[model samples]
Target: MSTTTMKYAVTDSLMMLRRSMLHIARYPSMTLPLIIGPIVFLFLFVYVFGGTLGAGLDGSSGGRADYVNYVTPGILLLTVAGAATATAVSVATDMTQGIVARFRTMSIFRPSLLTGHVLGSVIQTLLSVAVVLGVAVAIGFRPNANPAEWLAAVGILTMLIFAITWVAVIMGLVSDTVETASNLPMLLMLLPFFGSGFVPTDSMPGWLAAIAENQPFTPVMETLRGLLMGTEMGNSPWIAMAWCAGITAAAFAGSVALLNREPGR
Candidate 1:
């Protein structure tokens, strides 16, 4: 990274940031689901099935409170997934429109361009998390932990978003079209269904339970839940960080390799 290269990277990143913000400004409707979807999920699960599921898991007859605490982490993860979709779709659109190619033609730092998009996505993810948390509070989902625990919860969620954004970037670069990028987010959204998001893994069938307990999302959600509820994370925090780091490295390496492989001028 020569000074010139570093400068280019920073400049390119800033350009990408400006472009992303402009797109958001131009289309405010897309922001609606950032608040709506998570709220809906919170209401549907916490009110409808929270009683039965909570009772079965917590040994209480109707444990809506426990259910609320358990699912809050899952909902936050889902919000990050939703934000990642936008990142992927926007990157794919830029690639398809030849914008990336044009940038490549210039002396712009290629890595910076991707980094900028990832950074923008991370910012958006943070905003979405804040919105979800606010909604969670409104719906009686209070964190039992002190300020330190709350800070840790934020750190964990930030790490999760950082990792997921790279995955989204890879999808954007590899997908043949923007529509495909649009669909990639659903994969992240579905992880919770198979894990301990809505229910306890112990109660699941043996084989399925094993998989669910060990899945990345399970640990991530458990880590967040533990931090928020001021309870034992039971090995989830470390496992979640490992998963996030591994995925992020793989995705970043793959995306960079692909981008650098293009024919030279």
Candidate 2:
């Protein structure tokens, strides 16, 4: 793109970012669920079910001494789940209110509007992930990996959040109503249950194991667990990266295609 266009993109993106932050500031209650849902899930899994599950899995080996550590990654994923949904709702609300259409009629760069929303969501996801990490630490969860590995784990989670946000963006762009947009996030949240989030694939039935082993979330969880627990991820890192890339590509292409389609086409 030309320098003028690049400048427009940056400026428009910043404007969008500021507007989103303003919305958050004006209505602080919107952030409550982002904080609460992860904490609730962490407590339920770590305290209520942790002991029995850890004992059954580890037995005398003490292989899984800290059940909190086992579920921390899942909790981080949950944090992203909450943030992603909120982002979808915001974007959809803007679309339905003619905010996006109004902007499109202006001289502003169009893609930057979407970029700003996605960037804001990324920021929110990072903050939520940090809070979840803190909660995990307070509950006695410890990372077995070095600083580099921990960074890698965070990077993986960030990428997953980014990929998922695109899916949310697509929903926001296409949904006819704000209520419909809100449903997209809940649908995305269901992905973890089918993967290695709450339970290990080995503990599941054969058919379920097969599904979990191949699902995108399983590899992402495995990669995070490997980094946190210093265990072999069994090739999950590569699979996870592939899944992220695939989703990112598909979602971006779909969003662009939908945006470009004529209103009645």
Candidate 3:
């Protein structure tokens, strides 16, 4: 791209980003569920199911604390899943409200619309993750990671959110209704349960465990577990990053293609 075009794209994307942020501020209700869902699960699992689950992990009577540590990473990933749903709904809302069609008529960089959604969702997702992490710490979830590990955790998280948000943008782009967009990302929410979010793959049946072991969420969860709690990560971090890269590239291409073909664009 030429420098002038690049500059224009950046300017338009920033404007779109500001617009997205304002929309979020005005409709904070859209974000509340994303934050609340993980918290409810955290409390539900820790207080109600922690003892039995924790005991299974370490064979101790006071296993609730251990369970808290094991479960927090999954809950953190859940927060990102919730962000995906919110992004999809936001995009769908824009499409249905005729705002996207309106934008296409303007001379602004066309990609800026989706770019704004991705950037805004990243900011929102990270803030939501921080809030959830604080709650986890309050409820006996502890991390022994140094500054570098903490930074790595944040980096992986941001990458995952960025990748997932692009996928959500595509979901939003294709969805005919806001409700459909909200529901489309529901599968992401179940990923942790199917993988190693709430429990270990070894504990699952062989067939189920195999599926869980190979899925995206397990590696990401394992990476987080290692970073935060000093658990053994092995190749999980690299695997997780690879998944993020692949997903982002595919989703970005799909989103751009969809936008190009969009009616009235």
List RMSD in Å for every model shown.
Answer: 2.0, 1.9, 1.4
Leading candidate by TM-score: 3
Q: Which candidate, 1 or 2, would have the higher lDDT against the true structure?
A: 1
Which residue pairs clash within candidate 3? none
Question: Any residue pairs clashing in model 1, and if so which?
Answer: none
Q: After the best TM-score superposition of candidate 3, give how far the Cα of residue 161 lies from its true spot, in angstroms.
A: 0.3
**Residue-by-residue lDDT tens digits, candidate 2, 1-265:** 9998898889989998888888886877777788889899888887788887666554334223467777778778878877877888888898789787777678888777777888888887788788878978887888878989988988898889889888888998888898998887897677677777877778889998998888778899889989988767888999999999899889888876776566546
- Model 2 weakest lDDT span, ten residues long: 56-65
Query: Model 2: residues >4 Å from true position, as ranges?
Result: 58-65, 263-265
**Alpha-carbon local distance difference test for all models:** 0.83, 0.81, 0.92
| Residue range 14-67, candidate 1, lDDT tens digits | 987887777776876666676678779989998998887778766445578777
Best-fitting candidate, scored by lDDT: 3
Question: Model 1 residue 129 lDDT?
Answer: 84
Candidate 1 segments exceeding 4 Å error: 59-61, 263-265
The deviation in Å at residue 152 for candidate 2 is 1.2
Candidate closer to the true structure by lDDT (higher is better), 2 or 3: 3
Q: If candidate 2 were superposed on the true structure by all CA atoms, what would the RMSD be?
A: 1.9
